[model samples]
Target: MTQTTEFDWRPFLLRWSGEWSDWSDSRSDDETRSEGDEAARQGRWLGFPPASEERIVAMEKRLGRQMPPSYRQFLKVSDGWQHAGGFVWLLAGTTDARWHDNESGLADMFEEDLDEDAGPDERRDAEIWRRGLQLEVESDATYVLMDPEDVDDDGEWAVYTWAGWRAAPPERYANFAEFMRDMHREFHSLRAHRTEGEPEFANDTTRELDALVEKARLMALRGEWERAGRTLDEAKEYGRPRAVGLGDQIRRLLGQTYMVYFEDVVTDPRYAPELLPSLVAEHAAHSYRDDSTLMFHLRGAGDDVVSSAYATLERVRDGTYRYTAAGPFGEAVERARELARWGDTDGAWRTLMDALPLWQPLGPDHLAPMGWVADPLLGPLLTPDRGRELLSTPRGGQAGEAPARSAGLDADNLTWLADPDAHDNLTSYRFVLVEGVAPEDLPGRLADGDEAALDDPMTSDEARRRSLGGQREFSSYDDRALMSVGRAGDRWSFAFDGDPAHFDPRRFVSPAAAAAAAATAAGAGARAVVVWSGLRTWRGNPFFHLSVARDGAERYAFTYADAEIHRTGEIPRALDPDRFFGSGSGKVEGEGHAEAERSLLEAVTGEFGVHLPRHAITNGRLHTFTSRSWTRAPGNGETYAVISLNLVRE
Candidate 1:
């Protein structure tokens, strides 16, 4: 609860009290044991529900803090409202007061790191935001909070929302009163908003016809979205220039319902049978005839769930699916349940399975949009001692635990991982793929037992200096890509920047990445390049990296997954060879190693074939990264580097 200084904010609740009570009466039967039994609560959203005096007192005592008088008075007037004051706040009720600091919701926004491009001022605000008490989840990208440090005995903490998209300091209100007043203004205008939105299909050319929508547009600019949307609806029609020019009104109305719909569809489980179909019906009007437009509106918007839903529904519309909705996630649960009631259990199960990839990145907590689909909703459900074990094995995505190194590759010289010599123990291994090169170029050559290729690798100056003088034809070789023959895992994870906690493992395997890289190399008319990284030691760090093509070589794009590495860097494009191996670079004590130039990641991509856009290459440092220290002594003290697998085109 937040205090109101000059004005009592409780009127906001009083004005909307009946609206909230109606919601509670409608949703009371929706509560179930299944939602709670899922190891965590599912779809916990904001709604105004009845609160008892006794329950409110207990909740206050439990939190060890008194509610701000304005908010406290609000609760007394009408328990707690889910989406109160037109802002997103699932203001907790008496029983829902416990804070889930560990929950993966907007609760994490308190500790969100500054954006990479965040300025000094924005960074300072994030540091300040860490101190605020999170009040509720405003949306996926934002949260409401009361800053305790800024308050005193009056319990008047300024309320603000932490929204990442907003470049300014998170918007703040003087108190709950101001916030409520602003919200009240919009609801009062709903009539005008909707009146202007009614279509005048016959008046195609007159500016007078568009006047109503123009008024609603001003409301939208002032953040009166719900009213603006209703007004936009009235203006909707195929020939209505007002709606067409302003936005696609049919879609705009559907978009407007998203937030309110999230609250209703998630909390009203008892009415779900009818509510779910009605929710889907809102989307039924839009026809997705072209893939490009679909991709633009869905993928380009970065909305995976909606994009997947549109794609899945398209398949159903085209006869590619029989009896399922594989999701935009939230709808899938309802669709699956409906299918089961109709005796399509297999379809229901498939629908649920399709959603696994969607939540995998959210980790094993596995939240559903409407909580858990009742396991025994009458179909033969698979019972297991552990609920999570009931789900199928998920493939590469930061969906589960960090995979331990492959025992086959991280061994004392196993033949399968290619190093038969019981020398330097393998600590880590990554299936390397330079964005625009074939796996046959480097990884392929090393696997072929061509030790001579690396032993007399082109000297630093030869490749860095001599190669720049002319269009030289370097020797090339290729073999069948055989690396996929073994039981190697097929995925690469991009943890948040380089932090492992937020790593999202995906299904892209190395061979596929290599093939992508190779295709790009071929298309660029670049010569094959391959080399071995050996002389391994426990004291030294080893990693696979590909260098970008030098200046004269059509700017060959290679790959390195991380944008930054520990204290080491790529060689400069035009620096002399000696300068690269100098102490400032990867040079070890009493040992020298060449460094390669760092290249911009933007100009290239995994255009090797996969259309994934987030993928980018950090310039390679292949030749310059081979320095190992022999000073360490613990295990069998032998340094090693040998081929694991290599296949190239003959």
Candidate 2:
């Protein structure tokens, strides 16, 4: 069909015969479907017997023309074929192949709808459909039509595939063989998502090609990217169905190209940290909203990786952060920048590409040399080649240390913690600070019993799981409530623990109340201050509550849950509520409730001398404990929402 005399159909048809199934249910009997099994046992192809030369001659006499060379050769190999991939059930033998009957009326419909403004391709497609030979004996709303008028120099007719339901025009191919190859590829693509029980090709050449594609895949995963690229290029030459996509993948990793389809992007875990953020940014430029495909995969690299990327994006957009290159890579980037500034963008791009191999991350969040995206001089000059090169090159390196931070509290340092949408978890924060206590002692003091221990301190993630009762709906009424404790100076801070998504809503209500009750019970005359500040609740409302416990007794409490306010004791003269939530307050224009929450936190911390260091609370290995007495019991008449439940009568 491709006008190539060297082409052979026997090998491909043999492979198809081995793997073919009547996926369309065109064959009604079990005996017909069992032919392949019997043939496999006998070590022979299952294709039907080839058409004799006399049959071909008679069909040509009836049609008044000779069949296309490739199609004619194909008939000599197999009279007919089953499961030519997609919706096609079988190609017709010489006995049934004839001029189209136009029973579907698609040709007449398209002809009547044709407009004078239609393009050349559209007009040609309509003409092909209106007067073509039908080759399919059976199919599901699929047409295999060949046009004699659209013949090649070697008298090979152009083939067209059309589905009645699809909105697009008919897909044209060079000839019958090209169309069959595409359908074979479609078969592979359709089953690509399934990772189990891969099909074995019967033919040696097909088997070899499939093996090459898989080998390239494994090589890419092992960071043998150059080798994988070469393998994929070779597999492509062999006409492997998956080779083109796999080659694109290797190209993406090598920074020679980029993929619009994010799911197809497979990152080497070693380079994911360096590549994912830039990958996300590249996708973001083309997309209107965030892409979950790359974002979810990017998050697998590390905990702070996604957040750090977001911070970088925000800073870049706001013009506050600029990437300053370091080392040989940085010097090359500088040269590129200088060249770009001089209006020699091509030179700048070439300079950047040349330095890609020398690229190393300056810091953990130094995603890439992304200056080009933001640089006015270089932004306009970026082509797919240059952009993908920046995205995927400098592919391998361990991240450097983060920059040092100042000791005292900086407003900017609190921004990420304050923003509700910034991180996936810990959006709702509640902390209790008790004076005159050690970090380890806070856990014991805040628990009903001595269940809280420091001998086996768990990581924050482990503590979160234990606090939620280890994937169960309920723990015993006396089960401990997990909390993290750390010291900031003379005061110890006890935080309500567990990631926000995992925390049971029934257990989260008024956390300050339970925490205060526990703290003051063991206070021994010490003062404890509790505050729960949420920029936005699960219901999308801002909430705040503050309470104080002194000398083993609760003294004061105040809450601002959306529009309502509740107070338990006389407000402290120092904490003037009017100052924070006066007229034209609560929700400010442009800046929502984050500003209010931040200001209130600052005021409360300053007034009560409550301090929780940003680093210690967020990153340090603080002591973890669970309160044995903090438990909840719903009334018999009360309704509850739960993922799972178990009742114990012990």
Best by lDDT: 2
What lDDT score goes with residue 127 in model 2?
Answer: 74
**Tens digits of per-residue lDDT for model 1, 183-285:** 4433333322333345322222224436766765544433343465566554542123344323332222223334223221222333233223223333432
Residue 349, model 2: lDDT of 62
* lDDT per residue (tens digit) for residues 232-283 in model 2: 7765654555566456544543444354222222233333333444454565
Q: How many backbone clashes does candidate 1 have?
A: 32
**lDDT for each of the candidates?**
0.35, 0.57
Model 2 CA deviation exceeding 4 Å by range: 1-3, 19-46, 195-207, 210-246, 249-259, 266-268, 273-279, 290-327, 334-347, 353-380, 384-650
What is the model-wide C-alpha lDDT for candidate 1? Answer: 0.35
Top TM-score: which candidate number?
Answer: 2
**Candidate 1's error at 274, in angstroms?**
54
